[model samples]
Target: MKTLWVLVIAWASVAPAASMPVCSGGHRVNCVVDGDTFWWRGKKYRIADIDAPETDASCEAERRLAAEATSKLKDLLANDFAVEPTGRFDRYGRRLVIVKIDNKSVGETLIAAGLARRWQGRKEHWCPAP
Candidate 1:
């Protein structure tokens, strides 16, 4: 019985937990990774419906937008949200998912807020060509 209790406690420690707005790196289990990705219970997930600006983008505009988008995503995930898998994974092997809160798509929310754009099956660079 003691051994069983210890096992249960160990499992509980590694279980998926409440979302927290943390993106500063280093093995986060349940925290936002960026504008379009996050970690939940040691699993990485990519938002499947929209593409937010990338933090590594060369353009300053993109970098700023990425920060805002990331912040917005963090805010949304801070509450009770659902991670519905699309049964797919991106080229990078991140599980594709659509996050929702109260049946409203989180991607749509980011789009409405101008922090992200609909995923059109192609990469649309957020920086304008000089």
Candidate 2:
């Protein structure tokens, strides 16, 4: 009985290493990397399910938009926002989080602003299908 109790305690103390939980707590943290990619809670995060133009992609306008979107995101966050994970991870192994600041979604904002396009498939670049 004592051995079982000790084992249970040990297991309880171990934090889950895979699949981050959805944002349940109200506590917010600082943005360490705000350039299209960011980190929080000792975990590196990337916006999931969206593909923005790359800085050097085929489309010159898109590339510029990518940079602009990145900059805008940084400005919008700027240590004044809260985020919640969608309970998913991207291909790069970065924790995918749905961000909100002042009850506004930063991703949707970029989309509405024509800064980013919806991810067609599961890749990092945006491409339209025929």
Candidate 3:
């Protein structure tokens, strides 16, 4: 009985850490890595619910938009912004978060500007095939 109780306690402790970080409040961003990623207090975070063009894109159009997205994210994070975790993490270990600037989500802003798209469980092409 005692062994079973110990195992249950151990599982409870490990479960939350294995899931994802939950942001009850917010944290100051240290730097913006891209339109969908940033650094806060030395930890890397990925914006939740949205995906942006990759910085190392091959297609010309994708590359161009990726640069624009990165620049826009940099500008947003340069001010007094905060990141709210989405209680999830990507496979790459980036914390899924929502960046808020003036109470507006940066991801939503990027999507509105056509620089990003809402993440739908898979990556979508940023440019058409040649």
Q: What alpha-carbon RMSD in Å does predicted model 2 have with respect to the real structure?
A: 10.7
- By the lDDT metric, which is better: model 2 or model 3? 3
Question: Pick by TM-score: which candidate is best?
Answer: 1
| Local distance difference test, each candidate | 0.83, 0.58, 0.73
- Give the 10-residue window scoring lowest on summed lDDT in candidate 2: 12-21
Local lDDT at 82 for model 2? 56
Cα error of candidate 2 at position 60, Å: 2.5
Summarize candidate 3's per-residue lDDT along 1-130 as a digit string, tens digits. 9999986554321111111222224563355666788666658889897999987777889989988888887766666665666678999999888777776887899999999999999988887877
- For model 2, the stretches where C-alpha displacement exceeds 4 angstroms are 1-36, 124-130
User: Which candidate number maximizes lDDT?
Assistant: 1
Candidate 2 backbone collisions, by pair: none
Q: Model 2: per-residue lDDT, tens digit, 3-117?
A: 9998656532222223322223445343433334655555677665455666656766656676777667666655345556667777778877666656566677777877766
Model 3: colliding residue pairs: none
Cα lDDT for residue 81, model 3?
65
